[model samples]
Target: MRKFQNRSKLSQYLSEQRTKVSSIGFVPTMGALHIGHLSLVSKALSENDFVVVSVFVNPTQFDNKDDLVKYPRTLEKDIRLLKTLSENRIAVYAPTVEDIYENKVVSKSFSFNGLEHQMEGAFRDGHFDGVGTIVKRLFEIVKPDTAYFGEKDFQQLQIIKKLVELYHLPVKVIGCPIHRAEDGLALSSRNTRLTEAHREVAPFIYKTLNTAKVMFGTKSAQKVTAWVEKQFKKQPLLKVEYFIIADIETLKPVKRKSTKKSYRAFIAVYAGDIRLIDNIALN
Candidate 1:
């Protein structure tokens, strides 16, 4: 697999490829390549002539310095996995912090007034802005015909959609389904940090959402949230950060209404010091 660090070299490589009219699919990641990330890479490989995966652990996305410090970095293992997945056809671009953002000058900030400030955004200030800036930068660097993002980070996906619309970018943004474990826990790099007991109990978040969806069919929104909160609260290993039955688009807590619409059951939990998020949709 070919690798390029600086933009000039990447641009030069892409320019040569463009002459041949090759369609590129991009998967941008904060390199701790879990199955969730590889799922996107797999999708890209299936649909495009060429695939480029950028592995840069973006510092701006983390609100907590300690979290950033402790964030997993498995570059050698990640590269080995990617090589095996690609079967020698994938190109990897693992850039240094200096190479990606030398001066730290953010081009423009994306502001989704209501959507950015709720749930995950409420807890981590400027988290989506960090997400937006880094993603936008990657879009500029990769300049792929299509970009893939996993739906595990639902809010981040929404924000990226908005960013593309607002900026009138040429690339297509696609959201892939969340990959999960056999037991239903959402696949995440953070999952590696969970203790055995917490890992055993973590699937309850999905179970709670499943129950909430069934209850929402006949019950009020308040009842659903209450029940979900109660179930999560019962888990000694899981501490619920925020639990809400929200409108899927707005991410705002929903109230009972006569006409049915879409809803999302979302949760962020702190199992010891590691934070994990998962959600399910109810229609």
Candidate 2:
């Protein structure tokens, strides 16, 4: 696989590829590559003639300075994993923070129709703005025909789709299904930070979401939310930050399920200092 750290060189390479290929796919990541990230890249390779996987850990997205400092960085190991996918078709752009932001590393303001003010937004202030900033910058840099994102970041995925619409960008943003472990915990880069005991109990997060999905059939959204909170309260190790069943589109917490609208259960749990988030669809 071709590797690039300089934005200019990567741009030149992509420009050349554009002439030879009909379509280009892009997958933006923060390094520390895992099977979940590879799943997105694998899908990108299947649909496009060429794929570009960026391995830059964006700084503006972190609301907490300590979290940013603690975030994993494994560029060497990440490239090795990507190599196993495809050598000729994949290009890894592992740029430095300076390469992405030039001088000032700051986030730009974006109106996601209040989508940003719920759930994660409620807790991590300006988190989505940073997400918007880095993603927008990368989109401008890569300029791919299509971009792939995992549904694991369901809210971010929606915001990115909105961003493309607001800017009238030609790129297609596709949200792939959430990749999970054998135990049902949604795969996340932060999973590596989980302590051995916490990791064993981590699967409970998904187990509760699955139970909430089944509960939706007979219970109100508010009741289900209460039940989820209660379930977490019983577990001392895992702290529930926020759990809500909201409309799949607006992301506003819903009181009851409707036949015309779809809903999803989103949860954020703290296993010690490591925070993990997961969501499940409820029909």
Candidate 3:
């Protein structure tokens, strides 16, 4: 696989590839690749003529400095894993922090149709703004025909869809399904941070979500949420941040079960010090 750490080199190369009429599929990631990440890569590989995977931990997106500091950096290992996934057919654009932001003189403000005030946006202050900025920058840099993102970050997927419309970008943003482990815990890089004991019980989060999904068919929204909270409260290791049964479209918490629209159970849990988020669809 060809690896380019310089933005100019990568952009110029991708531009050249464009002249050849390459249908480039882009997978932008904050490093520490896991099964979930490779699943998105697999989707990109299956559909596009050429695939470019970016492994940069964007500093601007972090709401907490400590979390940023604690975030793992296994670049060498990550590249090795990527190599194993695709037999040197994939290209890696692992740019340094300086390369991506050296040109930005000022922070540009973004309005994601009020998407910035809910869930992750509400909790992690200017997180999506940073996400919007970096993704917008990468889209410009890569100039791919299509971009792939995991539905694991469901809200972020929606924001990017809006971002493309707002900017009138030509690239198609595809949201792939969330990949989980056999035990049902959604695969995450942060899973590495879970204590040995916590890791064993981490599957509780998904189990509860599964139960909540089944109950949603028979129970009211408020009662379902209450039950989810109570279930989480039973486990000392798994601390629930926010649990809600919300409409899939607006992402606003639905107080009552709706027979018309689809609903999703979204939850973020603090398993030891690792923060994990997962969602499941409910009709």
Candidate 4:
């Protein structure tokens, strides 16, 4: 596998590659590689002639400075993990902050059409703006025919779709399925920070979501939400931040189930100092 730290060299290489390949697939990640990230890369490899996976922990996206500092960076291990997938077709771009942000590190203000103000955006101030900025920059630098993103960050997925629509970028944004642990905990880089005790109870988050999904049609959205909160309240190790059943398109909380529109159950929980978020589709 080819490794690139400089954006210009990578761009020049991709330019040379474009003439020979039918399609180039891109998977932008913040490193701390796991099965979840590998799944996205695997999908990208299957679809495109060449795949570019970026591993840069973007500073602009974190609202809490501590979270940014604590975020995992396993570059050498990440490259080794990537190599296990493919040696020739995959190029790993592990750029320095200076390489990605140049001089100033700031996010570009983007109008996500109220999609940004929903769940994650409501909590993390300017989080989506950071997400938009880095994603846009990476999209510009990579300029792949298609980009793959995991659906664990459903809101971000939708916003990126809007980002592409807003900018009219030629790249196709594809949302891959969420990868989870055998115990049902949604795979996240933050999962690395979970203490042994916290890890034990982490699967409860998904268990509660699955139970709530069964209660969707029989119980009101409000009741289901309250029940979810109560379920977490009983667990001392876990704390419910927000649990909302909302329409998939608009992302606004729905009071009643609508046959006309699709909905998903979105939940954010605080497991000790680490925060975990997961969602399930409620049809």
**How much lDDT does each candidate structure score?**
0.84, 0.94, 0.87, 0.94
Candidate 2 stretches greater than 4 Å from native: none
Q: Which ten residues in a row have the lowest lDDT in candidate 1?
A: 104-113
RMSD of 4: 0.7
Please rank every candidate by lDDT, starting with the best. Answer: 4, 2, 3, 1
Clashes of 2: 0
Model 4 misplacement above 4 A: none
Each model's TM-score?
A: 0.95, 0.99, 0.96, 0.99
Clashes of each: 0, 0, 0, 0
- Global Cα lDDT for candidate 4: 0.94
Per-residue lDDT tens digits of candidate 3, residues 1-283? Answer: 7899998899888877777755899999998999889888888988887889999888888888889899998888888888877865588999987888886633457898787677887788788888998899999988888999988788889899999999999899999998999999998888999899999999999999999989988889898988989888889989988887778778888976667898888888998778999999988
Which 10 consecutive positions of candidate 3 have the poorest summed lDDT? 100-109
Per-residue CA lDDT of model 2 for 1-283, tens digit only, reads 8999999999999999999999999999998889999999999999999999999888899988999899999988998999899989999999999999999988889998899999999999999999999998899999999999999999999999999999888899999999999999999999999999999999999999999999999999989999999999999999998998999899999975789999999999999999999999998
TM-score of 3: 0.96
Against the true structure, candidate 4 reaches a TM-score of 0.99
Which stretches of candidate 1 lie above 4 Å from their native place? Answer: 105-108, 258-260
Which prediction has more favorable TM-score, 1 or 3?
3
Count of backbone collisions in candidate 3: 0
